[model samples]
Target: MAGKKEDEQQKQLEFEQDEVLTVLARSGDASAFNELVRRHRLKAFTWASRISKDPHLSEDIVQEALIRAFLNLNSLAHNHRFLGWFKSIVRNQALMKMRRGGLYRRELPATALQTASMHQASVQVDDINSIMDYLIARSSQAENDGTSKDPQVLLERREWYGIIRAFLRVLTPREKSIFESFFFQECSPQEIAQLFQISVGNVYKIISRSRQKVQEERLSFLIRAQIRQRREDGLLKQNVLDPVSLKESGGSLLTGTEQLYRFVKARHPQLSLSYVDGMLLGAFLLNIEKSSVDMSSTNMIDRNYLITNGMLNLGMRVRYVEAFDFEPPDPNLTTEGIALAQGSVDLGMPAMVWELIHSEFGLIYGYDDMKQQFYGLDTQSDEMVPYEQLGRLQTRSLFVLGFVGDHPISPSDSLWRWCQMISRHARGQDQTFSGFVNGLAAYDTWMDVIRQRAIEPLGHAYTINVLRQSRKHAMICLAELVSEWGEVKSESEINQTIFNLLNKAEEQYAIVHDRYVELALLFPVPSGGEPNEPANAARAIELIKHIKYAEQLGIEWIEQIAERLEEHASRAHVPAIVENPPRAYIM
Candidate 1:
């Protein structure tokens, strides 16, 4: 009886390992997926070598196959059949590589090449309706009754659709309308907003919420299915619950500054430092500053802009995944958020997590399952906080960053996009808050508050620090741009003039930043000190005048640069639409 019990336990253990790993992997648990890869890599490699016959080529085939498998892991109908599905991918990739090589060889002869080209040209194309009908037929067969007769197969076919439909049924009427309008009608967010009598951003919010609901429902379904399967297989006895824990061994794949440094190094190893700085400039990661009466105490100007736009401006194709908004953070979203973070790190990409502590952004590089901790870079230092602790702090933002394989846009085009972003931002056109100003007008608004002696010492100090840091980084980025594009002798004179204006503005902003720094030191952020005297208020008003003058000068230069670029475009016979600066706040 004892020996039989041991045998039963062994079977249960094996079942648990397979089912749990697959389920977790499907749910984007990186560690579980890594384990699955480790167990299957040797077999996959062996299969590829047998098909390719060339060891070097087989290695490439296997790697590509694995990457494709991981990318399309969700498409796998049956978790138990993963090995077979993966093997098929390997075989197909290897066969396609061999066929391409063979085709190239066959094309060597002029007669063969001519005959092949003629044959390709003569191939008939199917009409859209015919192609659609064929696809529907194929999909219906697969869903209703494919070759498989297994119970799991039937469960997947019948229950998966049913689960999705059930979730759709749970949506409110408004949500359903938005969903249908966006997905079925293929309407733009702006169009949907008009139809619904809402803002475009609201349309996005509704869609995002709907997607989150569907994702949560799917996860619940998968977990339930796995539990049922385990019971049916007799691997789990009645009333027995499988132990679910997220713990794995291994240090971070990339740590500290290495995450940012390595990404740049991978692309331009020879000039790694320059590339790293460029990324920093592009990402606005280097523009660390403080702000008050803005959204937060300290603000990174780049934070207001999309990192995707910034990277694109730097000539990188980036897919932006806005996990969730940070306002009104919810603890219930932690599981999905953690999975997203881990998945990004598993891909050798650091996820930017917001509100790590003190409303700051951090790069999450690693997690410790046993400790239930996440390792990240905070503003002050590298931090390792309990997962639960971090979750409770209400971090609702995440970014998965990766480089594109190739630059698809020209440098000139990228520069134009960057200019547009800058112009829009500088004009307060993108401000999200009422009564709060942004761009050049923000300086005037801030001055008005200071002139009224209504700003708190702490708030003034914070704003000063933020402005100082923003200007410093702006100077760095502008100087880098000059070094990059100004050396082109063929650049139009007007374009050259714009670059000179940018440099001048950078210098002017630096002086303004320095003045703010001096003021901040005079009226530093209060740390439980006596209240500021009335005499200091008079001094503050005088300082505001100097700041206002410097800011106006900077804005003038920026406006001039914009006009110069527009003039150059006009002369070059290119249509240019330059927007006048938006009106500033009444001060």
Candidate 2:
């Protein structure tokens, strides 16, 4: 009893402190506002960092947000709600930075906060206050009525487990499995899709239907309880009880922002084309097609590396940011993700998100702060994910865009770098996997795996798909290079020889690509089926051997081309190598 009394006193003291700070800050006490900033700086920085993925920029955004909060302090109706209001400001600032391509005036007049009026800030504050009031009232009513038991909370209490078990009975077996996997086990839709041999779209549909069923039953129970209460109270007239709308109970807070990409383009004149074209251009500059596979995982490769390489290859700077090195139990992770995505959208650049619901690369293009929803496209589908939903994923990776400085390597120098990379790949140098070989040698290792049936059928199929896609892109790159360099009249002989070798290599890769496509169809990744009979498996092995032969031939041709280019470099007027080449952060 004594300890409980002490706890209450402590809480009261903290409340008083908060009230005092709030009042002082609102009355233009600069020191009080600075104190508030000091208290919330780390959290605000964390939120901004998650969104912008750039610590330097995140710091700028947080400072701007605090200044804005100070200027608009009068707009806040309640001092207790200061943190939430300030968080919203930080989110908005991050979004604005993203839309402006990270361009913001760092210096503000010292008196700017004091001089600014609260008129502009009142509108947003009023909106936030209204929503908060409604939610608070609803929560209070639920507590008073003894109907505040959340489904998850009930499940946690072993005595109340029966309640959840009974509610789950409404779902069919398949629906139950999907619901459990999605909500309980926390498996991503893509992982579930792979396990069940279904599409990601179907996974979502199933989860939705199950949730709707549960909600309908819940509504039915509530209606029956209300009717019984009215009957017991001797209220004969039906009008005595207000009608309840079923739609209200099942409605979601998730919503999408309108015209975000359009707004981005309008604001930034340099981005004349669609994001798709920009992504492709980045890919080409980085030579991503050449480094899309890891010999060990087969289907898995380091996407962060690819993005970084692409940006660097284009002479553009980049910053890699992550929410955490390892997963944390903090609830604020989702808020951070939403803010980060919103910031990227505001910048007019897409946030390249990793470990999405589909276990694939997702581009977050828009966000609705009011509804707390992020709109993005994955390899499987375009969808709107709730802000809270982002926290459930395993990994949260972000790629923050930076401006392109002067060309790090000239066109000719870039070509030379490409030659070196290709040679390294051909020789299987700098392999990421220790046990498994890489590049040309990876073909032999893969062939061995196929012959032994060591890899799963679905895994093999996915690998083949990656190979086919990468090879097709490689062919495009080769063709583009040939066309680009072919016009140079000075290096005609050498260029023709290089072009001929490239064409041959393209043909070789094309054949291998077509074979992989055929093999992938036989395995059928979406089916999640077992490999074919022994004869068919043997046939695949033979095809792998053929692929190996073709790849070896391509390697020989590349080596010869490298030799020819070197010889030409000796005779031709090659530009002297710069002593200090431009440097940019790679990852």
Clashes of 1: 1
Best by TM-score: 1
Candidate 2 C-alpha error for residue 525, in Å: 4.4
Off by over 4 Å in 2: 1-296, 323-326, 329-347, 355-358, 366-375, 379-409, 489-492, 521-532, 560-587
Against the unseen true structure, what C-alpha lDDT does each candidate score? 0.51, 0.51
Q: Which portions of model 1 miss their true places by more than 4 Å?
A: 1-304, 319-348, 355-359, 366-409, 489-495, 525-532, 569-587
The digit string of per-residue lDDT tens for model 1 on 262-341 reads 43333444433333333333211212111224224233233323444545544444332323333222222344455555
In model 2, the worst 10-residue window by lDDT is: 249-258
Per-model TM-score on C-alpha atoms: 0.45, 0.43
**What local lDDT score does residue 220 receive in model 1, on the 0 to 100 scale?**
46
